[model samples]
Target: MNIPDIWRGLTRSRLFWPVLTLVALAILNVVVAPNFFSIQVKDGHLFGSIIDILRNGAPTILVALGMTLVIATRGIDLSVGAIVAISGALACTIIADAPDGNNPGTVVFAVAVSLVFSLVLGSWNGLLVSVFGIQPIIATLILMTAGRGIAMLITEGQIITVSSAPYKVIGAGYWFGLPASIVIAGIMFAIAALFTRRTALGLLIESVGINPEASRLAGIRSRGIIWTVYVFSAVCAAIAGLMISSNVTAADANSAGLYIEMDAILAVVIGGTSLAGGRYSLTGSLIGAFVIQTLTTTVYTIGIAPEITLVFKALVVIAVCLLQSPVVQARMHRRKAAPPLPPVPSGTITTPVAAETAGVAS
Candidate 1:
């Protein structure tokens, strides 16, 4: 392809700008801290700032992955944060009360119960939106508001801590020379990508997102598709909850996964998925999650005030959103393509009277 063609392709690619932003951030990080990208092996496991970012970012990545699918179907799950809290609360509460919380069987049982509860919560959301015709935001908001209270009740308004070594391994341990959380996130992404692409699921979701009525008329079970996505999103949130609670070995109902939904949504937007719905990219969302984590780390490395770190995040998000905006892009194109005013003859520069008369005629 010619230079202009290649340029156009690069500009049009959805992943291009986010990727560019991520690379820029990484470069800045390296500049600020020379060892930013350095990974070292200790006890047969990889450890480094970059590795920690991936491991810590894993939960957000998981949530964003599911959010991509839900957004692609013109839906949002505001309750994900609450679901995360509930998952952690339930599991930790269960494990804490067990005679031997560290037993593999106890941990497994607690995990199973948490997942099942999450599925039920997901079904509740699906029923409201798909069957009751409620708006996605409002429907999920119900749980968002109520879920924390439920979690508090589950833990009796106390933080539930556990001593399960097996459970701790899930979020804090290493596997195959990598963080287990990172491994889990990678596996989840792979599964989602393969499941949607290898089947007709992805197309159906896009169709529903583009136009639910049209998809229904076209013989697609749009309701079922929509319902399934909500459930899927919940499961993703539950798994993230496990990772989060595992990391700390405690479940604080009031604060676990707080404001996480916002981050997940932001990641989805940064990844090129529209709030309006339709197409999505899991890969982009994964990268967006890492971008967010890296930004947070960079803030700390630069010694920025913790309170003002959010302002930096806000600025970066605004920049990304503006860069992706079609209106901004179109205006830029117009400015570039507009011709410079024709050069007037230097010796015959118009007098004020002549210039005023020409302007009036125009």
Candidate 2:
């Protein structure tokens, strides 16, 4: 109803700090580059740094969205990056080997095969975690370690290139005056949000994350939920792989989606989703994805040395995490709520000892 109330409400929200950090990054970029926020229409499409950020960050956002759910169930998927590589490798390999790679039918078949492979990989991860009771990290690590090798085999230890016009549309094309990747990411985010929020699945996930044994006792089907999340995560990664490979029109088994799992995990953490599991936020992940992409752009825009870029990014992430920490927030709130020291009598100098004595007396 008033300023303090509104401020309090905002501070309590999970999205508050992430949104603030994104705005701060944007402001920093605009300060460095006057045209950072400028968007121009060209050939019926938007072109600008902002759009580029959205387009570039779309894959990470998709991965983070799925990772949010996986993490919500007290699980992690280190194999997502590998899945990304495998998906792209398989698709490109198939298309390159096809009789007519540019045909829509060939592209569709390749995509279907890639998606199906992703589903199998996801199921394997789920089986390890849900059925065998393996630790989530360990289960996914198995795939993470071997996934690239598998991809290499699929691509015959080389990069697979294709010339499918329809395939390129997935990553490099435009639709409705926006990047197609952005549209796809938006669709996936909306589907995830509605699927979880509109149904009882979200509550079940939180319940499982908070206490898996208790959830099982209450008949929450914890195993099924866990398995489903991993599958969904792999599928999301697969789609991201498609976009990445399609953008370049090639899939390099060794490099396709390299280290992307780290970025996705960082995005989820920055977006206010605890790696410890339980409640999550998709919108926060979206903002956090943009934050990461924008930060990367900032590094280039400001001309940071190549060797130091990673260190700089790490430092910024650390700062944001510290600011979002509960202890820091508590301290900040306490400081804000604490009454200001009664202004010292005008022009009166108080010795440190006298100030301490006065404070103790009060």
Candidate 3:
């Protein structure tokens, strides 16, 4: 019934605009592009731009899933990127030192060690935020600043080349005609989804996010949950690091997982999670990751300078965020939320006979 209300409703609809945007982008690609949907097999390998996105973006999606949980509790893990760097370095060091054709044990040993360190790092961040009352950003920032340095120290400032097939399989191997990263990401997503669904952790996270004081007063161990999520985020980063190293058959401490946590944060935001906390949607985050990767591929294919993608994507995300904000949503809901007109003044009701008489007279 009102212009402002209609406009706000349009902006606030979570599914409507995000879906429309995705469709519009696809349409644009189809119209102004060459075979955007076509897949090709060449040299005993499958090739497609879409497949490339699925392969390359899976790790980001996986990391973003963990980030979504962390942010759902109004927390951030700035050290995820660093964890990736360190994990890759750890893996490569083992493989590099292993004798020729003796990589199986080394790979397992390295993964175990890397996971242990990630767990500790995550626990440290969690303890700082939970027990010491440090802000999530501040706590993780301390690690972020030191993590890369630690990674470099692990690698001795040199990129370590690893020629292990098992390690490489994480990045380059295929299963069911898809990249291994895709499969691993899928498994992680399913497990996360199941854990959150089957347990009360999801509700606990939301309660803490919505009202931490209330959750604590209700006897919930909010701090423990917070700690668990930070550790989970570190584990995700480590897995991503392995995928990165496996793809290239080498680990570069300085380059692997560089600025990836930023990408993951952007993804969580784009997926409709409030930065202020209380709710999260992993499916949406997965979609957001795909959207990001699609844009990257499109930029490369369209001959647009790769550097422009950061600016372009940033602007697009900003626009989406503004549209998804409470201001816009509240405005949109007004028309729907307004009370229906009163049937008639209680004393002004007319009988059916009177209605018939009035009709006859008319």
Candidate 4:
């Protein structure tokens, strides 16, 4: 209702700092590029820096959404990037090998195959962790290392290209005057939000994440939940891979979705989700994805050297993490709550000895 109350409410919100960072980055972009916020109609489609941020950041957002769930269940998927590469590589290879790459049926078949293969890859990770008792990180890292090689083999160590108009629409076309990628991301976000929030799935996930042994004791199907999250994460990465390859009409196995797992993990962390597991925020991950994209855009817009861009990004991320740290927040609150020194009376004037005596007595 008032300034202090509003401040308190904002500080209490998990999304407060991430939203603020996004706003600050947007303001910075506006200052650097006068037309940064300006959107215009181009060929009946919206075009602008903001649109580009959403469109380009869509894949990361998708990956982050799934990562949020996996992290909530006390797990991580380092194989997401590899899955991304494999998805794109497989899809492009399928289309390229087809006699009619542009045929809608062929495109659909390729997409289906890519997604199905991604499921298998995801199941592999799940099997290692949920069934075989391997650590999530180690289980995923195995695929992370081997996925690119698999993708390379799929493409025969070459970039696979295709010209399927229908497939291209998935990533590069416009839908209802908005980028198709944005639409797809939005739809997936809604599905994830609703699927978890509208059902008991969210509570079960939090329960499992909080204490898996306890959950299993209570008959909560902990293993199934863990396996499901990994599978879901893999599917998300596959869809992202499809969008990326579709956008460029080509798939470079070596370069596709490189280091994207890092971005997705960063997004989940920046969204205020703890790596320790339990409790999560999809909305926060969405904002964090934008934050990452905005930061990347800022680096290029500010003309930072290529070699220094990573350093600059690291600095900003470190600052943000520190600000979000509980220790830092507690210190800030203490300073805010500390009482001010009592003001001296208007006519009061004390000699040095008197002041010293008063100070000592107090």
**Per-residue lDDT over 1-362 for candidate 1, one digit per residue giving the tens place of the 0 to 100 score:** 88876776787777888999999999988999999889999889998989989999999998998889999999999999999999999999989999998799999999999999999999999999999999999999999999999999999999898888999998999889999999999999999999898899998999999999999999999999999999999999999999999999999999999999999999999988899989888888988898889889989988899999999999998999898899876664452456778888875637998878777988
Ranked candidates, highest lDDT first: 4, 1, 2, 3
Per-model CA lDDT versus the true structure: 0.92, 0.90, 0.83, 0.92
Those runs of model 4 whose alpha carbons end farther than 4 Å from true positions after fitting are 335-362
- lDDT winner between 1 and 2, please give it: 1
TM-score of 4: 0.92
lDDT (10s digit) by residue, model 4, range 157-273: 998889999999988989999999999999999999998999989999999999999999999998899999999999999999999999999999999999899999989988999
Q: Which residue pairs overlap in candidate 4's backbone?
A: none
Q: Residue by residue across 281-328, what tens digits does model 3's lDDT show?
A: 887788777777776766676677776888877877787777678786
lDDT score, candidate 2, position 46: 96
Each model's RMSD to truth, in Å?
Answer: 7.0, 7.3, 5.7, 6.5
Model 3 Cα shift for residue 266 (angstroms): 1.0
- Number of clashes recorded per candidate: 0, 0, 2, 0
Q: Write the per-residue lDDT of candidate 2 for residues 94-194, one digit (tens) a residue.
A: 88888888899989998899989999999999999999999999999999999999999998898788888999999999999999999999999999999
Q: Estimate each model's TM-score.
A: 0.92, 0.91, 0.87, 0.92
Over 4 Å off, model 1? 333-362
